[model samples]
Target: MKEALLLQVETYVVDLLNKQLAATNYYHNAIHTRRVVANIEELASLEACTEQETMALKLAAWFHDVGYIYTDQGHEEESVTIAISFLKQQEVPEDLLSLVEQLILATKSEFKPKHKLEAIIKDADCGHIASENFIEISGNLMKEINAKNHKHISEIEWLQQNLVFLKNHSFYSNSAKQLWQPKKEINQLEVQKKIDKLLAKEKKKDKSSRFGRGIETMFRVQLKNHIELSAIADTKANILLSVNAIIISVALSNLIPKLDSPSNLFLVYPTLILMLFSVASVVLSVLSTRPKISNVAITKEMIKEKKTNILFFGNFQKMSLQDFEWGIDYLMENEETLYNSLTKDLYYLGLVLNRKYKLLRITYTVFMFGIIISAAAFIYSYYVYFSV
Candidate 1:
């Protein structure tokens, strides 16, 4: 009669769990409960439990997680209530029904078992921690928690938590301790290995992130410096341009008309020399400030080869916006290509600055020499005319 009652309990709990358990209860589903039943049977046989004790254990295992169909919090107490109600309807004796309730409650993670029977059921409930598929099983539990709580728990974090639980936990039954302790140690090592690998990967990723930031900073600083220098070069060219323009205007308005007179013939050469140098200075200044137009159009082939810099407008100005956007996307996806393009941009900018500064230098030199020679020529022309 007791055997038939146990079978009824199993059938009822299995059906209830199948129909009512939430999909998110990945670790505490029907399979887990069935495994617990199997574990308790093996443990009971090894410990030489009486038929009554064994029957109570199997009944408790079947009902231990049924309350999870409704909720997870305080489910052990609910499980006990369900066990009592079911066993009473079966006309079970109060003594055996009470033992079944106690055994069900003993499976609570925080509960300390009072005797060998409680110990057997509790050990069975947590048997998977020593099982060969512990990692896969633990992963499912992690997934279940994340799904139910709507939060992410990384694998490394889950493994660390498992390691702490393993270090603190031990089987209550002597039979369980003797049979499963060695395998449990091996599972601990496996968890440690996984944790170590995850830590190493995180460390490498952090280092790479820092290095990438450093590269960005370098590019930012260098590009800013290049733009500033270019602006200064343009300013210098503008100054030379204004100065030479004024000199040419003054000569054309004040000096050139006087050169037509016979008495002013000596002044003609001096004035001509000044005018020629002023015009040359003006030309050089304009050249220094002029924008360089690139005739080489950026093609799709060059962009694909990573040969052209899409960041510089001069390189891509002639291309359609569609092509330019495609090039930009390609550049962004490739780290090496993006950095290379930036480096090339800086190098070309430096070259342009070098040419501008060189031209400005030559313009300043011409203006200075023109002023000195023209002044001396005027002095000589006046002395010859007056001494005669």
Candidate 2:
């Protein structure tokens, strides 16, 4: 008969919650009520609660949040009225029904739980806070709050509010406290990680707001200009290298063999001069385009200390995702450090550009001088040898 009554109450509450509760009351719907009942059963076993006490606890859990169907404000009183009506219809004993009412009222967070049964119900009501599903449950709560209250609290603010609530909350029963404390601490760590992420985002947004768009625009434009200039220098150097290589190849293939004959001896110095300049230009061009990278490994501590430039590939290419994320978080948290890293990136890029352009200039000079000097040498040789 007792098991039949519990089942009847469970079915009735599930139907009531499904049919009457607002869709927006996601965290307080049938699922939560069911979880509360399950939790109470677990606690009852651990604490060795009496058969009547267990039945009352389960009934209280079923009817605890039922008042949300009519109104959210002072829902506990409404829940008590509903529970009494249901118990009277079922012909439940007066004392057990009264105890169920007390348990239902004790589930309210603001009310201090007085009796052992009250403590069990209260702890069961918030059991998710110490469960592995805490994170997902918290998200549903946020969505529910947003849906009902129409308030758009930021994630960081929500986390802060939740952390305060958790800090002040405790499981009243020794069984619950012992079983849940470690898991609660784990949930707290998860909350702290979320808070850190939100803080990182806020810091990045604040930095952008403080710096204004003009500073960012200036860096972007200057960096683009530097990259374009480097590209141009590389193209010009490639052209010089190609032209000089062909000239050297033609001079060696067509003129060098002829130099053994006395009649073609005059072309020797001209061919030599052109070949020397062409080879030199090729070497310089290769040097300018050569890639250089540091193979040194960086630690997370270096990134935290702002000693690594996360903007450059060499600094983070070998690092793990966790370490790289930590580096990015550190950079995002500090505007000055982030700006300094960009500055260092730009400075190194400029240095590379300077080196490329300088080498390219020398290559162009050598090619131009080689053309003029080789033409002069050819002209004089033609006059001295072929004019006879």
Q: Indicate which candidate wins on lDDT.
A: 1
Model 2, span 141-160: residue lDDT tens: 98899989998977778888
Residue pairs clashing in model 1 are none
State model 1's lDDT: 0.89
Worst 10 residues of 2 by lDDT: 300-309
Error in Å for residue 129 of model 1: 0.8
Model 2 superposed RMSD (Cα): 5.6
Write one digit per residue (lDDT tens) for candidate 1, span 1-388: 9778888998999999999999999999999999999999899999999998998899889999999977899998888888889888999888888888888888888899889999999899889999999999999999999999999999999999999999999999999999988889999999999999899778756644644778899999999999999999899888888888998999999998888899888888888888888899999999998998677899989987878887888889899999988888877655566777888999999999999989989998998998898898889889988888
The whole-model lDDT of each prediction reads 0.89, 0.88
Off by over 4 Å in 2: 204-388
What's model 2's TM-score? 0.71
Steric clash pairs (candidate 2): none
